[model samples]
Target: MDPLILGALVAVATIAVLFSGVSVATGLLIVSGLFLVLFEGMWALELMPDKFFGKLNSFALLSIPMFIIMGSAISSTRAGADLYEALERWLTRVPGGLVMSNLGACALFSAMSGSSPATCAAIGKMGIPEMRKRGYPEEVAAGSIAAGGTLGILIPPSVTMIVYGIATETSIGRLFLAGVLPGLMLVGLFMVWSVYSTWRNTGLSVMSARSYSLREKLEILPRVIPFLLVIVGVLYAMYGGIATPSETAAVGALLCLLMAIVIYRMWSPKSLWVVLRDSTRESVMILFIIGAAGVFSYMLSSLFITQSIAMWISDLDVNRWVLLGAVNVFLLIAGFFLPPVAVILMAAPILLPIILAADFDPYWFAVILTINMEIGLISPPVGLNLYVISSIAPDIKLKTILKGSMPYVGCMVLAIVILCVFPGIATWLPDLVMGPVR
Candidate 1:
């Protein structure tokens, strides 16, 4: 069978599986296995190289599990709750203050955990209840958290960045650094939007301006310091070349465990067991999707599909910026139905080559790609963050989640345009901090 036909068939099968309500990992594995059988023939296994699995065995890949463990440990501990309290106390004095604080805390927590669901779960638990107690509307509480949770991917130490770097062979450390300004920018955008929206809606009441005394503000510092330490420690180790990304993750995980057990004293035997169990389950799910993506990507490469697609795209007469806009449109559409990781795995292989062939800066292109994926997280019909928030706040209809997310989605779009116009926003910091990539 022609590999192109086989590739299309695989693509179609993947879409079918995705819509079938089957797990994506299972879908990917099934499709990959089918491709292997159809293209390689049943007895052609010996012709396949061992290198397929080798791609999955990177030290960088180890970061995924360590980061997962770190996120789980932090979420399971009382540290997340404490951090939220500190943020609430500090920000509650402003208009729409609690929501702004939620966004800020989500951004900070995102730097620590690097996973969206973890960010949502940790902060949503605290932010939602507090917002409700403060007489904020349920929609406002749920919407802010659902939208803010996406900062996890844009912020540094982001697992998504690690996955993106691994997929594209870009510098993971530099990618991590690149996210800082944009992440904060997005947080600021969200805060602005929250304030604006709250102003428009008279139903939402602002918290009274209660000033925190120096002692009270100082008291919250103890809770804030641990998270600060974790962030500093991880970034210092990675940027200083004292540790590779995976090693930084391992250290971060250990630090989180220590904070949980020694400082927070939440690491009861049962709690530890539960954390390990959840981590294992999440890790297995992620690894399986990655492994299956590896297989599918391999088959795509074997068919020269990426090269063909790149050539076809490059041959177009349109301006390069126009072409990039088109690429963003493509990714946005893909994000509506595809998971962010799946979008990266499937599109990066094809798109990176095209961007490079066009002589676009790799770092700039990476930031662009990252922003597009972030938008996907909030897109309707199938945005994972939306579902996570909806599940947590079940009373809020999907339509409400979709409606509430529009302003943040617009913010992300504006962010993408900013990065597009000023590539320096993404590239300059990495060069300044890490020196120019060789």
Candidate 2:
């Protein structure tokens, strides 16, 4: 059989299995192993153990679990609620201020946790009820946090960016830095839409449930400021080259745990166990998928499928922007099926070379890909975020959540276009701080 044909079959089969509800890591592993045996014989199968080990052996991969732990520690506590409350105190006077605060809180927590579902679960648990209690529309109330939670992968300390850096051999610090501007840009865009939509749909009088006194506003800071500091510290360490991504993650995780203990009094053994257990479970799931993806990539390369695809793409005679548009569409669709990390692991290696050949900056492209994944998180079929919001706010219809989120999805699409026009939004910070990539 033609390798290209087999490659197409394998790709389609992976999607079918994922949609069939088999665990992503398991499905990828089974597909890779079976295809390897049938296509390359027993000897090829035998080599996979060492191959998968070599792939997973990276020290940088350690950051993923630590990042998960950092997120889990906060989500397992009232810190997310604290973070949202603090934002509301400051922003409550503005129209749709509460929702804006939710978006802001999502960005900050996402920077800390680096997991979208955790962000959704954490902030939504508080923000949704608060918004609803204030008489915000159910769609706006739920849609805001659902869309905002997608920031987990766009903000710094992002797990997906870490995976992309590892897969493409790009600098993790640079990728984190690359995400900063675009992340902020998206936050601003979301806020703008929220304010306008609230003013239009609800009215200018809309606000939080009540106002806080100056002292009340200031009091909450003592509890949440330290967590905010954790975000700043991690980025500073990454930006200053003070530590590697893994070391940064380790320190950030420690600080978050310490804060959860000292501030939230989450020091009981069961609480600690819960954080560690949740983090470990998610970490293992991601790592297992990564290990399997390593095998899958090897299979594609061994079969000449990867080369054929890259060459086929390279040989296309189209304007670079047109090619870029096609890649964006492909990523958007792929993201709807796979989590950002899995997509990065499987696709980055294949796409990075093509992106470079097209004269697109790699870091800029990372932001663009992330925004696509953000849309995926809020869309259907496999929109993890939609279901996450549904679980948290059981009363809000899923279709309403989807409807409310649709505008923000358009906000994301607009963000992508803006980044394309000014790629510097993603590249300038990294270049200015680290010096241009040679």
Candidate 3:
């Protein structure tokens, strides 16, 4: 079969299987095995073990589990609650501050967790109920937290960015550094929308139930500030050449667990079990997808489909920006149905060469792709964050959550436009710190 036609068929089949409710890892594995047998012959099966171990055997990949463990530790405790409570105490006097606190907490928690669902569950469970109690609209409370949670994959320690670095053979540290500004930019954008929406609706501020004294506010910081410092230290370690991501993740995970234990009294056996169990489940899920994607990538390359597609796109007589817009549309569609990590694993490889061919910086494109994934988290049919929020705040109907989330979705789209206009927002930090991708 012609490689182009075969590639098209494989893509359609993969999509069909995934949308048919097959697990992503299983769908990719089944597709890879069937194709290898029919085309490469059954002997290809012999090489599968090496492929699995080869992809699974990365030291950098070890960071995924460590970071998951870090996120899960705090998430399984009152740390998220403490973080939001502190923010609420400080921001309560400001208009729309309750919503602001959720977005802010989500961003900070995301910096620690690096998993969108984890971020949402950790922050949303506390943030949403409190927002409702303070009289913020269900949409504002649910929408902002859901949107803020998407920041996990765009922030430092992001599993999605790590996966991208691994797939494209780019520097994971640089990728982590690159995401910093764009992630903050999204948070700021989301905050702006939250404030404006709240102001427009009623100017009815969601103040704290009672005023907080200076001492009261100061006390909350001891619990929250250490976690913030841990985030800063981990970022510094990666950027300042103090540690590899895996090393930073290991230390960060240990510190977060210790904090949860001492600060929140989460050292009990069941509490420890929840942290480890969640870490294992989520880590296994992501790593399994990575392994399967490796085989899928190998099959595409071996069959010449990857080359054929890149060649075809290179032959186009269109403007590079136009080509970029087309790629964004493709990503938007893919992200609408697939989880961000899976989307990154499958599409980032296919898109990287084309992006580089169009004179785009890989790191800048990482931000753009991550923002697309953010849109996916709030979108329906397969919006994992949507489901997460639903489970967290079941009283808020899905439609209400979707309605609240749409404006933040618009903010993400605007953030993408802003980054496109000034690509430096994504590239400047990494370039200055790392001395330009070299």
Query: For model 2, what is the alpha-carbon lDDT of residue 420?
Result: 88
TM-score between model 1 and native: 0.92
Cα lDDT listed for each candidate: 0.78, 0.87, 0.88
| Global local distance difference test of model 3 | 0.88
Each prediction's TM-score versus the true structure: 0.92, 0.97, 0.97
**Which residue pairs collide in model 1, if any?**
none
lDDT of 3 by residue, 1-438 (tens): 998899999998898888788899999988888888889898998877678768888888989999888888877777778888999888888777788888989998887777788789888888888778878888888899889988988888888888898888899988888888998889999998888887777576555456789999999899888888988899888888898999999999999999889888885898899889989998999999999999888888878999999999999999999999999999998889888889999998999999999999999999899899889989987788888999989988999999999999899889989999999988998889889766
lDDT for each residue of candidate 1 in 1-438, tens digit (9 for 90 to 100): 554555567678888977898887667666666666766687534433353465678888999889889988877866667778788788778788888888888887777776777778788877887777777666667777877888887788887788888888888999988888877778888888787777677444666757888688779777669867898899999998898999998999988888888877875799988888998898877776776677767767766665666777888888988888899898888888877787887788788888887778777777777778877787777678888887777777888878887778888899888887887888889999889877
Each model's Cα RMSD: 2.3, 1.5, 1.5
Better of 1 and 3 by TM-score: 3
Q: How big is the positional error of residue 24 in model 3, measured in Å on the Cα after superposition? A: 1.0
The per-residue C-alpha lDDT of model 1 at residue 212 equals 83
